[model samples]
Target chain A: MLRLFKNKFFLLLLITVFIFILMGVTAKQNSKLNWFSNTINVIFSPVEKFFSGIGDKIGSGLSYFGDVKEVKKENAKLKSDIDKLEKDTADLERYKQENDRLREALNLKNQFNQYDSIGGNVIAKDPGNWFDIFTVDAGTKDGVGNNYPVIAGSGLVGRVLNAGFISSKIMTIIDVDSTVSGMLTKTGDQVIIKGDLSLKEQGLCRMDYIPTDEDISVGDSVVTSGIGGYYPKGIFIGKIKEIRQTNNEFTRYAIIEPVVDFKRLEEVFILKNKNVGNTGTDGAGK
Target chain B: MKARNIVFAVSIFIIVVLQTTVLHYIKIFGITPNIMVVVVIGIALLFGNTQGAIAGFILGFCQDITFGKMLGFYALAGLYLGLVVGIVNKRLYRENILVIIFFTFISTIVYELSVYLVHEWGMHLFSPENSNNLDILYAVRNITLPEAIYNSIISVPIYALMIRINDRFENANKSIRKY
Candidate 1:
């Protein structure tokens, strides 16, 4: 046994077996890190955050120089747009009060809007191109937890995969492993949006299970149906980009152009359900 | 020797931090060069199999913990890569830039393909969706080839730096031995 241990090839084989075993054990979704990994994360989070801040500053600084003329033109355009939006907001506020009164009369719950959200910065991304997982600066300390729905400014990003002490891993919607229950905003048809390995390079997702007879067209919006307990209802996913016919004529899949610019993603918001206790199958069914 | 080990360990940590944070901004075609693979190759070429393997394992483990869905996949890839490169260390001209670049390009392809295979196998075992040969062909053309090219280009400066550091450590060790 001592001589076998001394043999380099034998030692290599042992380590290989050990690692394979470790992979098997931790292959499941939402696997908690051991003490060693947790400790490393605890130490690495702040450092990663600091470096990410510097990188962000450098990136913006470089872009600022290159796009100064364009920025000024865009700024003037945005000012007019803001003025128009302010007038629209005033009209919407009056409508909102009337809607609130009607909702109170009907005793209907505001299913999507009743959640607390914590903001986080993207500190680190997965080192390889194979996965779209990233580390965010929010953790359980900030009331962020596993399976919390994360979103960017434009639309749905993904959900928290694992929450550490001061950092959480987010699996974005473009990752091959990600799947969300979504619906067409125009026709109210339920569809499954999943990440495909080939499409991930283009920062797009695959929307599958569309009924043949559904009048779904390119540019129709898709949102969470709230059927999956993970995401709340009515969160904007993306617009259909292209429709493709499957081998089975009854079903088709469409490519989705996600509204979030995932490559340039810097910040995100993780939504925490206020009524956490009642987030059961009953609510999912509705 | 101890100082060399410390420097290697610290450099690995720094590489991980830089790869995750700073490297994301510098992506070409939505893919960052795998700097860890370059560094592992550098170590294996400079120090032989044992050190190379150890470096690969450590780097792989760090990546697996931080970003991987499975704990040992990267670790396994890194370990084998380091071992294989280290085995060839004895016969190669370590100072030749082209040789290093060629090694890095090939190693990255092997590393990424192994990762793809393991992931596909896992998907086959656990998930309902089975990836077909088209997906494999697409991955090789789009992902593996571009990544390998990127890694090879970036390997030049990184390998040079590793050579300098290794030379400095060896000279210091020689002086100590003489004393």
Candidate 2:
């Protein structure tokens, strides 16, 4: 039996089968294997700090280039003119649709003013191709907790999947296994946006369970429904890119392109939603 | 043995730190000039295979920690590359800087290619939905020729630097032997 198994063909086949089994078992339970993640992060913090120094230099260099006399003068003049126009427009359209969105956010803030907002920069991205997790500079020290909603100016970034002493890992909305109840901005049709993390283009999230008869159209905007308790209502989620009614389900599904450009994510606000439930499924995939 | 091992460990620590941090800033197409690769190749040329494999695995693990990618990906790749280079070292008599640079370049590709193949294979069997249809062949195309050429160009000076460091160790060893 030993000699029979010693054949190169058999050995290769055995190894191949073993590796396949291993990958399958591992991927299925990868969330449970969060043992080394913190240790790895701790070891790599110095490296991240080093790169941050270089980032500062590059940022300063760009700022210096922008401060050239010709460019600076032009920018200042453009800014003043735009400021004047913005002030006039603000007064004329103070109660119009433009202010409505801001007002809604202000009202939401007033309602949930108990939790302080902590701002942090996205430090490093997950080095692997599959994991859509990124690290932020602030953590427990700044009162950041697991499940805190992270958002950029455009829309939802993700939620704090895990938090460390001085850093936190955000599992972005683009990650696989992520789901958010979203409403069509124009028609108010409710659908759940499912993150297809397997896709290469990160912004792709699918709107599922929409009735086939719903008046959903291409280019319709989607926003959080606020039913999930994780996100505030009317926050932009994405725009419908495609709609398909397959035989597998009664509801038509549409792919959404997220409003946030996750690739270039820098700074973000961590919103402390009081209604977020105690879902034990924090950072380690639990 | 203790002092020499410490020196090797220190050198590897410095190389891995520099590779992920400073060199990352100058990255072109995610291919940073890997000084750790040059160091392992240099050691294989000088001290042979067993030591080479050990060094490669250790440094590769350090790299995995810094990169924060799927764990053990680079470690396994480096181990295989080190063994192959060690086997080739037995039949080769060339040790010029340019020749070493070429060896480093080829080994760097080997290391990267091995990791890429592993990742592709992992994704295919684990998550078919995420798998790219072309597999390794597609990954090879994405790497492009220019990135490899850039790695080769940077490998020359970095390889020279490692050789100098090795020479200093050898000189110190010889003086200690006399004492």
Candidate 3:
């Protein structure tokens, strides 16, 4: 035993087994970070946040010079868009008043009105290409918890995987491990929005298990079905770009162009329900 | 020895911070070079198997804690990578640029393959869906191959830096021993 203990190869083998054991222990979905990892994350969060800010500044500064010509064209386009939007705003105001009246008469709660949202800056991204996980500069101290839905300016970003003291890890919907129950905005048909290994490279996701007889078509919008409880209902997911038939012939999957520009994403909002435990049941429960 | 260890720890921390923050902007075709692989191989070649393995473990642990769903996947991969590189390079010339580049390219592929195998096939830890749904050919063609090429290209400068740091420490240690 002593001879084996002194063997370098033996020691390496032992360490490998130990790490495998550790992996098994922590691989569960509900596993919490050990105190050591939690402490390290707390210490590193501020440094990461600082460096991320500097990186963003440098990126924007470099892009500003290259964007001069494009900006001029965009400015004109935006002016025209603004003129069109001004006319639509009046019609939207009347609709908003009617919507408010109908909601009060029906005694129905607003889809997202019951939640309080906190903004977070993305501090870092996963260094590898396999996963679409990123860290946000908000945590338990800021009331951000696990499974909270995250969104960018345009649409749903993902959900929190783990929350530490000063930071949290978010697994974006484009990750292969991620799956969200989604619904078609037009046909009210249910589909599963999943992160595909191949499709994620194009900054897109796959919507599978589409209903066969539905009037779903390209350019139709998909939103959260709110079935799995990780996300609230009616949050915009993406627009279907292409529909591909599977080998089974009965099933089909559509490519989704997500609204969130994940490549340039800098800030996000985490939705926290004002009344705790009201968002839905825990994911494991479902 | 203690001072050298401290330097290694600090450098590893700095590399990780830069990797996650600034490295995102420099990605080519959505693939970021795995500098951690290059650093581990360099440390193993410059130092010994023990030092290489320790460095790899530390770097992997940091990544696992920050970015991984599970704790030990990267840590285990890194440890084996460092140990294998350090042991295999014992009889080879370490200073040759071509040899370093070759090793970097090979090690990056090995590292990524092991990660994919474990995450996608072996454990099925992260992906809740069936593993068959994942296309391995796509992963190799798009992710592993490009990453290996990128890491090899960047290894020249990084290996040079590692050599300089190793020389400084060696000289400091020699003077201390004389004293």
Q: Chain A TM-score of model 1 versus the true structure?
A: 0.81
lDDT of 1 by residue, B75-141 (tens): 8888889989989776479889889989999999988988888787777777656342237787888
| Candidate 2 per-residue C-alpha lDDT over A99-200 given as tens digits, one digit per residue, 9 for 90 to 100 | 567546544333335445679886666543334677777876777776677888858887776665567778787775466778876666778887663343
What TM-score should be assigned to candidate 2?
A: 0.68
Candidate 1, position A274, lDDT:
82
User: Order the candidates by DockQ, highest first — what do you get?
Assistant: 3, 1, 2
Q: Is the docking of candidate 3 incorrect, acceptable, medium or high quality?
A: medium
Better of 2 and 3 by TM-score: 3
Q: Which candidate leads the pack in lDDT? A: 3
Docking class of 1: medium
- Ranking according to lDDT, highest score first: 3, 1, 2
Q: Whose lDDT is higher: candidate 1's or candidate 3's?
A: 3
- For model 3, residues A1-286, the per-residue Cα lDDT tens digits are 7786479777888998998888877766456545556678987788889999999899889989999999889999999999999999998999999977854564334778888898999999999989899999998899887788999974999998887789999999998888989988776788999888888777899998888887778999888888888998878899999988888678888999999988878899999988885552376354
Q: In model 3, where do residues sit more than 4 Å from their true spots?
A: A1-6, A66-85, A88-109, A278-281, A284-286, B122-132
lDDT of 3 by residue, B81-156 (tens): 9988999998378999999999998889988978887787753653445343656788889999999999999999
Displacement of residue B176 (Cα, Å) in model 1 is 1.6
